[model samples]
Target: MDVQLRQLRAFVAVVDEGTFTDAAILLGVSQAAVSRSVAALETTLGTRLLDRSNQRVTLTGAGGRIVTRARRVLDEVDRLERIAQEARPELRVGYAYAALGKHTRHLMKAWAVAHPAVPLMFVQSNTPTAGLSEGIADIAVIRRTLADERFDMASVGCEARYAAVDTEHPLARRRSVRLEQLTRYTVAIDKRSGTTTPELWPATMRPQTRTVDGVDEWLTVIAGGQAIGVTAEATANQNPRPGVAYRLVTDAPRIDVRLAWWRDDPPPCLDTLLAMIRELYSAAPPGLPRQRVPMVVPPRARGRH
Candidate 1:
């Protein structure tokens, strides 16, 4: 008999328990079966695995080596099983840089409970809303998006855009200010996540520009009155930066939060997750514009030759 897994199990159990009878009880096998397995293993390995005399059962040098190797083999087998179990019912979800806030974290936990069967896999990407179109993700939560003929778009929520400014700013006294009123102030944004190029170049105001990796840094600058910024409402509430205040941007585009999936036949649970998400977070719809990547028409089609 070649060195086998069963033999190793029996050998380890007997060594661990210090007796064949105890090992048999632990393994739920007869004592004679346990003893036979160990003896077989010793013969196959050509090494005495244990020192046994009278009532004493101890490991030999060879036995010590086998046990060390055996434990590793068992551990690897267990790991493979766990990985296999996690691979089922998986969802590849993506979020944009700005959208990766407390809402995502909170919604993730709620989503987990709502759909215990789905294995969610999320990635933060620049193309947050286009994930479904690019075939990189099953779903995406995005802001500044619009209806896509290729997609069945509906508002999951929205985030009110806050005019971030210092406590001492001239406009800070009022509860709110129209976006156009801040034309004179510098505006920083996550330009990467924006839909337009130079993105601020298309704007009415040529405000000073500052590109940030995320919202936290923008908050700091806003608090210092160096530059004003816009943030999702959920973010503003998380930590209203010290010496800083936020208020609605009047006539400003509210960030539209949407749950977008492929217009094609989606997984059954996708529908369920969407329903639960709406039910749970239906209150306080994130205030923001619903934006989308529009399919561009060819120049040939646009000109009336």
Candidate 2:
């Protein structure tokens, strides 16, 4: 049947208000218009929806069933409209691991104050490029270099490295551990999305590698003493596992924090986001050991394979 959203709204309003006159007042239209809308809805559904022989209008048996369904339809239409309105001019940023690490709250609050007109959303995905490659995000916070030449990236900050081990593991007793010390244990790595790789270690001293899919799995395996995990300081800050202890990886290379977007159609606020993130990292507490660095990818090197 050709039922319109307006007709459903009118039907719901009439039922809620208990009279066509009241519904017309709520809808800001004449009583005749409200009556006509309800009539059209009943005609389209091919059913008697209301009995209006007396001053008090009442629903027929079919009207009760149809009103319930019509109200749901109208409510859903209202929700759809609201979603469209709210999503317009909104920004969705994706991340696979620690989202800005310790600076997440500061970044969000600052963004809200700086761009009150735009809504910022953080979407989490476990894929290598967060959700960027899947078209689920406008930009992504990535820890590793994106292999795709279609993307342009900027390094906003760098985080120190940490080694995650079980609380009961011998290495956990130490305040910090060297990369070579971790080589003695099996290393749990999320090869697809993680920044750590066997190449981080000297070829002869490479630890036996165990594959993991995501941060949760890596933590679980590490906590169970199945393997040790090497990750950026952000992961340790964001995920403090009860059974897992994170020790500084004193000898490992720092992890670069990069913001990436599709080069051909970069978001308008890309530059602003990068600048704000750089500021947040730069202003971070010195104890966190955050390093503020200029964009590592040169203008000439951007968008290049």
- Go through the candidates in order and give each one's C-alpha lDDT: 0.68, 0.86
Task: Spell out the clash pairs found in candidate 2.
Answer: none
| Per-model TM against the reference | 0.56, 0.68
Instruction: List model 1 lDDT by residue over 1-305, tens digit each.
Output: 46777888898888779898899999999999988998998899888988887596899988998899987887787789899986577787765644434455666787787677776767656653646667677787666554577676667655566766787777666667775677777777776454322342336565666776555666777887788776566555555567777777666555666777777746457766676556656654444332122344567899676
Q: Which stretches of candidate 2 lie over 4 Å from their true place?
A: 1-86, 285-305
Tens digit per residue, CA lDDT, model 2, 119-200: 7888999998899989988999999978899999999998888888888788877778898898889999898889899999
Residue 238 CA displacement from its true place in model 2, Å:
0.6
Cα lDDT over the full model 2: 0.86
After superposing candidate 1 on the true structure, give the runs of residues whose Cα lies further than 4 Å from its correct spot: 1-7, 12-30, 36-72, 78-141, 144-155, 192-204, 259-270, 280-282, 285-305
Q: Which one is best on lDDT?
A: 2
